[model samples]
Target: MSVVVLDGSTVRSFVADEAAFSRSVDARFAALDTNGDGVLSRAELRRALESFRLLDGGGFGSTEPPPVPSEVAALYDSVFEQFDADHSGAVDHAEFRDEMRRIMLAVADGLGSQPLQVAVDDQGGSFLLEAAEHEEAMIAARVRKESKKEADGK
Candidate 1:
């Protein structure tokens, strides 16, 4: 059976491509499309942000504030703007899928020679899964430490 080795970014790509992930993203977009107009204007986007804050236990009057990092928020805004092509302030399913495909291809290319493949055999799947699991643990640890530092005012 052909075996494929995947780098950390490739694993992230696969995770993003998962059907469950796609459905979750689609649901979020649908929810953000306020007014039933099938479009998400800037005001709708702002409402979505507020909704997220509320969902995450950070209400409008809460002093705790939201936990999203500045870099992450910037990234989200950039992506949202990019997807809202034509300046119409909305992204249909086609646009969303196109953007997602663009992002996936870019991530895959950045992974270099570490091509993430679907193996034909069980052994190959197991090997790749184990490697990805280890890498995920390492990434999680690093993220946790960084988050702690950010919380500590460091």
Candidate 2:
């Protein structure tokens, strides 16, 4: 696991780079589309989401009881519906990309200006981790350039 520092701007900048964002999202989509079909069936999406454990209760201590199975099912259904768009019963790459972009932007908004330390698994497919890595690479390149310029002057 690696800890990455990221703020809203970091994610926003990543999203703004349309080509990079699309490439990442497309790669993820391809992985999820296990059947090699061009689109994601509801079962495929639900299975993937379940594997991620995103539906697991937040770490926050809640006084309320855990959600019943039906409620969980409904929530998953709703999420699938959102990604389906056009009521097409399946999620195409375009639909998946659009929804992922919206979801990432919402996460960015929630993060606001506060930098968060996130521990991510090296093999975990996280877009935020990718953004942080990209930011670090850019900073490294700039530092190298400045050092070379100073060396040339001396």
What is the TM-score (0 to 1) of candidate 1?
0.37
Give me the candidate number with maximum TM-score.
2
Query: What is candidate 1's lDDT per residue for 1-154, written digit by digit as tens?
Result: 5455676465454545456446545665676676777666666776655543433535768787556677556755776788777666677765665665566557556766656565534431332353355455667989999999999985
Give the alpha-carbon lDDT of every model. 0.59, 0.88
TM-scores for every candidate against the unseen true structure: 0.37, 0.87
- Worst 10-residue stretch by lDDT in candidate 2? 55-64
Top-lDDT structure, candidate number: 2
| Model 1 misplacement above 4 A | 1-18, 50-80, 100-154
For model 1, state the Cα shift of residue 80 in Å. Answer: 4.7
Per-residue accuracy of model 2 over 17-71 as CA lDDT, tens digit each: 8888888999899999999989999999999889877656654796656667898
Mark the regions of model 2 whose C-alpha exceeds 4 Å error after superposition: 56-66, 151-154
Query: What is candidate 1's local distance difference test score?
Result: 0.59
Clashes of 1: 0
